[model samples]
Target: MAKDLQERNHLVRWGILIGLSFFSLATIFILIIDFEILRNPDITQDHHFRIALFILVIYFTIYATSGFIRYLARYLNNRYLTRFTALPKLSSYQESFTRSYFPNKPYEHIVILLHGFTASPQEFQFLIKHLEANNIPYISPKIIGFGISSTHLLSLAHRHDWYRVAIEKYDLASSLANKVSIVGHSMGGILATFVAMHRPVHQLILSGPGLHSAPSDLKYKRLLSLPIISSLYIRIVPYLPKPIRKGRQTTSDTLDQTHTGTMFQYLAIPINCVKEVFSAQDDVDITKTQSDQLTIVYGKHDLTVNMSALFQQLDHHNTPYNKMSFNNSAHNVLEDYDKEYCCQYIINLLKNPQKTNPISKLKKQSTTQVQADA
Candidate 1:
């Protein structure tokens, strides 16, 4: 038994050493690319070169230390060394649902669903299932800050930068789909509006949408601006000991069940990104301007968004929009409530163009007056 124990210990030590070495090599490779080591010829006696070397060394030390500490923490906290794992494969139901519902229709209309902050495309899985059932082809791209996408925007400095990239990519993707409709929830809704104003999309749907900073929003903005406070807050927010953030809690009453083995991707979105998005003044007036269609859907029990503020903004914009509300749903109305109804509504819009009038009422009135005068 003593010999067997010694052999196991030897294997564990080797494994940790191997893991640390691999991490160091990967870090070095990334640093080389970031510094453009191969392309830059004037490295000798250059201050930039020296700065890069110093930064690389600091990064290497920090990363190496982190890896070692993490490995030690795992061993000390648990008896077994946990192996790195991949994301879960799509289940039989999910596979069949994807194949059946998202059939490659001549790719006429593209429906882009942008999830809320700290959420992945997984949040829209239920909605996707329903869209598939209705044979509506859709693209649920994981925004830069979430899912498999890069988390560089999660930092306080680049927080809103993700939206610009997201919009550009979304427009490119939509051009292939012919007509595009943007659907966003929470902060994503704010982005959807920004896209609607700038990018050429067929329609817009805002669900429990996030809006620009008001006097009230400044309080949260100030909190996020503090460097140390924001970093610490973000690190702990994902793994909060309680089920809620601040006083805000999901209305689901049931114990906040966590999906095990799921990864929470980090993003470094900054306040400037938010400011830039909010500060943009579009030439198009939503109320006076007619688009394909604009719909704002909210849940009566939504915990994240202030409904009154959202309505006021829409009203001020003079955007010709319809408001739909779910009775007892939270922020995730498409998943927690009537997803089928939402999917069908989207389908009906795609099939019947007349449902969403593109021409302004002012134009119609002018034409009518001209005919009467003639």
Candidate 2:
């Protein structure tokens, strides 16, 4: 499967290169032919042709230079820059606390809820309540380097750290219940995938999983992978500010309209944290995924991660997963516009693992349909 994916990637690259070469050749031919028809004394002396060639040369030079710099930055970041750490002294905050719901009696199944990077367990507030109402047991724990007042820890924590926390939680859940199910959103989705692969998970529910990043984020991640570039870039700007406190009515007010802005989230995100997320995504293997054990929920308008690429990957691997989508929701479908519908969808999945509901009737869509939705 890996080889097949690699070959497909190579074919795509070659196709792009060949198409560009043909276009360039066609343009050059047209320029020369037009110049001769116009009775130009000499091709070399034609200012119009010289100007066009000059512009094309400059464009290619910039493109080549940028590619070289990107690779150089990645090399330096991997070789030496990884040693640097910017972790902060994380203190316990009320909003960042772990949420665990255990029924009075013994529960047969346990659900592990994992939040996105830089987000807190608060994102699962609605789902938590629904689970409680249904007498379902769940554990929503905060991952390291997130859900805190500072974001510096995100820069220091590697993908392994995040995976360790997930594993620990899964082991604990395994001991407590006979069956385990993991529900992860965003970056947490990737961690859930890792845990599901190694542990005995009964169900794997991923919401807007960060299997592949959006186009803009992909470029930024590639740029930051270069060691020298990452080091120098951090020196200039260590963190990117976030609008966590935006639209707050007062100093003590927490945004109550949604699950967002209800926690002590970081005011800024460490620039280096992008690399950690990229590494986290590397652990996910669509080919290894069991379609029968998977339930996917994603927003059609999600801009944080590349939904199109993710759907394409799953389809390519012939993974016919149970999928649900919201037209209005984005990356935070759990807490976004379709919070109620999303939470209910999850509740139904958990309550009826052995049965399919009307909403889940479309167990899976064809590749063409998935791409069109994306």
Candidate 3:
């Protein structure tokens, strides 16, 4: 299956390259013909060629303008962020530090929180409060590249570094507590799976896992997954605008509107960083995963991951897992619209690890809904 996926990805990459090559060649040929027509007024009678040239020129104009804006945005962002790159003290960035919460009672059970890509431990702030109030011991570790202002450092870090840091944090939690559960969001969900594969996890809760990207992100995913094309592509355009929320839905609930403190990369992210995410995801095989220890919490409005593809993979693997869905939430389920219900649901699961039926513990909400099986 892995080999087949790889072959398909290769074909997609080559197809994209071929399509772009043909478009470029056609544009050049049209330009040459137009120049000849201008030099010889009698040849200007070719109306079909003139129409084609006009269309291609308009397309090129839009593409070039978009590319220029992306490159300029990357340049300014990098220049601003480079100031923090030299700072020896990570403490300067409060969000960058790993957060650990040890209750008054001795640690019998502990939960490890992993934040998503381009996001910090701050994403779990509300959830952390709930965990603390309930006297639940938890540790939220900051991934190596995240929580810092420097996109350059983020680009430098690879998937291996992310996997290593997560495993180390898991090992630390294992030493402190008899039982440990992993609660991961987005990219963290991917890391959590890898950690579970390496060690024994009491429970695994994934919030909008990055196993499969949304339909909108599929083109970018395919383009960046290629080795040679991605490397060259990044050099030309290092960053692109991050997808924005449509309708009235907003991320204001998840992040503070007044605070300049960077909890998430709202503007844009390095293309190389995106490539690293795809690399980590490629290492994960859903068929080999142990679904018995897994529970998925996702949002119906999520645009970051393809829910249809995720469901297909789960059903095909016959991976039995407790699935919860929130209509009001997007990718950030922790502090999204259904946050109150989401946090309570997670707290109940952590408190009663033995209870496999998630629906039985939490009261069903009319506004938000849950699906029992995957």
Candidate 4:
């Protein structure tokens, strides 16, 4: 009976895979035909042969590549899940305290590092090393739907669900330290902001918070709100052939190889969730809130979040904060640039709490001071 059950499960898995493969192929065919015949009116009878040849080549390439990509993604995802799920021996220092500042004295503050979308706790491994050296108690939990977190009931609409999850985890971390400082990267930054708004955090550090919206945002919003359209699109588009060369390297690629492999594995997440998290704007009025303790950090060359726009929004909102930009860094500020510098920046914020807004500080120290005095 057990063997029979196992066989049935195997059959089910294969059936799903086969169905998806067929669906993708059909979607590609329809899209290519639709684009060629309906969208392009410039193609005349004289150029039909050339256009047809070009389309065929593009379609075949995309079709073959998509299948290969999906297969690899699935294979890697299974391997990752299996490795993480396996029980391992506990560390000898599981509960042991390391004293750095003073001999036999434990650290007082705890730093909670939150990684961004499609990322795992592994991304913060470097940051963890720095924390250990400083003897700072830190916990980096993989948000649900990412890393080792269960993905059974995961969906794109539930992206903001991390806010509640972070709160629950924060409560657990509070037992370890008198004060908790949260450092969030990308979407994790937005989640951190949600938590900070509700909780009494000592300090809030937002690193490339995924708050900005682009043209694609409008498309997602429309698709997510219309159930019929979204369902049809998902079923058809996943199989359809898209130009792989035109595909941009999203923030997901900047992650460590292992983490990137893990993320691509579960590309089955609902597109709605992706839309909700990426397109959803922060509704909280930072200026009106009494939570004045906040710090914003971003990389100068970040391709994900618009640093300038974010800075402008923060200033317009009159949110009390400090802005720090890493000169040679990308979206993953802590990992991409100097890990030690990022770590030390957090340490400085903890040691000396700055009250003045970062923009105000700059204004106060402007070169006009010398001219005004003259």
Candidate 5:
């Protein structure tokens, strides 16, 4: 399964190269043909040069704008967003959260949750409530470098810390419950896959899974996946590690496409962190997924991750998966308008763990059709 996904990733990389090639060829063809026909002999050589320069400037201007918005989003996330923390470390905050999500009761099933990148355990509160309402205990660990309480993110090295800590939480949950369910959102969705592959999980749920990546934000990743460029970068990255490559720290105030959790997320990633995410994703394999039951809820309009690519992953595994999507939601599906709907979906899945929901043959199956209006 991992091999197939790797091949698909390569296809995406080559597709970009192919598109650039065709665009360049077309541009050259137009300039040569147009030059011969119009042949502005009266126009000075500098006049033609200036026109080309102006076109280049416009193209680069738009590119730069898009890049700026992306970075600005990251900046705002690192600065303004509220961080939600949970775990043994923040034992002090437990008294407050307990009155809300953690209703004191005997536990049944244990739910282990992982939140999105630059997010905190708070993302799990809604789902956590559903679990507690059903007499289930849960442990939603804060990925080390995230949350408002964290201070070492800039100095932290890689995702290994996250994966290891997450596994530890899963083990703790396993000891506490008769059965275990794992849930992840966005970046956590990717990490959840790693645990589900090797651990004993009764069910697996991914909200806004990040398996599918947007081309524009992921363009820098292509440098590592591409052939000769990868070799050159490999030889050059050591001297220019994460800190230096991270450049200057900065923040932004808003994101163009709004969402409930956007403000809190760190939109900007250090170059090293980008490589870490890619490396982690580069290792995902469906064959390794050990769970007998899987449920994936994606937003039809999610901008952070591509749903089509993710759907293709499970479809290729031919593994039975319950695929659900909400029309009004975006990348942060877990925090969007349909959050209640998301909670209900988990409850339903847990109630019927053996039932299978197949991936759509033509497109993703919508929740309205699958669950039938609550």
Candidate 6:
């Protein structure tokens, strides 16, 4: 089976190479000179031809730059950031570790925190502190490709491994507590949903759940998964200053500009990991949730996820779920603005399950109205 897969991948690679080559050539030809319109008379005499040629040159340059952006980013990351950012020297604390704030107590509520891509359990520091203060026992498991600075190691982790880790943690929490509540951030949201669907989950909280995406964006993502393209997209973010170095800037300076304090390219997302996230979404059935079991919180200004698409999915599945949208917030909800309010909201919801909003309530009310009319 491995051999067959290998052969199939080989064929696919050849096909992609051929396709890209043809497309690039066609684009260049169309941009440079419309063969039907431009008859190659004299270069100097034909002003239109020269203008078209100049535009074509500019277009090619931009195209080449985009394709090679990966190599340039890799060079910059290795030179300016990785060495002095203090990442290769991972401290014990930087790695994954779990502790119960109030140990040795019969706990009825347990929270499982599944972190996001290329991030560690530390992502949930704020939430963990809250859980501790509330005397709630929780476990944060390390996904295989994370909690470390080794890029190659992180790149190798898959979605199955992430799910396995979550499942193991769930079992541990289940044995210790009467109810297991899952809180997932970003990619972690996908895992949380999976647990809620398959396991005996008491409550689920998703922070910027990265579940569904638009079909066009998904197609673009799949294209990025290709070898040459994926490599570039993985290592490059918008903030990285290309080949341009400021006056006497140290590695720390570069790190500061990119907001990568004390960590080596934390934003350097892995393609395999991304693929795994989308895979989890595709593999899981997220159409509906059990009564009062789910609460999804996302920033209204979240650039990564489509809130409309998510709401549409839930409505399509006839799923009843509670949702909250925060203003002036980005992807990470626990670390962003209004986090405290969200934390209190979660605490209140867990403490007072009766107040939880169920989408089905409106439907039930509508049904009652119809019966009265009939």
Index of the highest-lDDT prediction: 3
Q: Give per-residue lDDT, candidate 3, residue 32.
A: 70
| lDDT of candidates 1 onward, in order | 0.56, 0.71, 0.74, 0.60, 0.64, 0.63
lDDT of 3 at 26: 68
Q: Model 1: residues >4 Å from true position, as ranges?
A: 1-106, 148-153, 156-160, 212-218, 222-290, 353-374
- TM-score per candidate: 0.52, 0.63, 0.65, 0.57, 0.58, 0.57
Query: What global local distance difference test value does model 4 have?
Result: 0.60
Show model 6 residue runs off by greater than 4 Å: 1-105, 214-219, 224-265, 288-292, 356-374
TM-score-superior candidate, 2 or 4: 2
Kindly list the per-residue Cα lDDT of model 5 for residues 7-86, writing each as its tens digit.
Answer: 32243344445445555654665455545324666665645664775577557545655555566556544443234343
The number of clashing residue pairs in model 6 is: 0
Clashes of each: 18, 6, 1, 4, 5, 0
RMSD of 3: 14.6
Model 2 error, position 228 (Å): 2.8
RMSD (Å) per prediction? 18.6, 17.8, 14.6, 14.3, 18.8, 16.5
Candidate 2 at 148: error in angstroms? 2.2
**Weakest lDDT window of 10 consecutive positions for candidate 1:** 86-95
Candidate 2 ranges with C-alpha deviation above 4 Å: 1-105, 242-264, 290-292, 360-374
User: What does candidate 4's lDDT look like per residue over 154-233, in tens digits?
Assistant: 45336445655676567666666678888888878777776676677887888888767444345655665676887777
Q: Which parts of model 3 are misplaced by more than 4 Å?
A: 1-106, 245-263, 290-292, 354-374
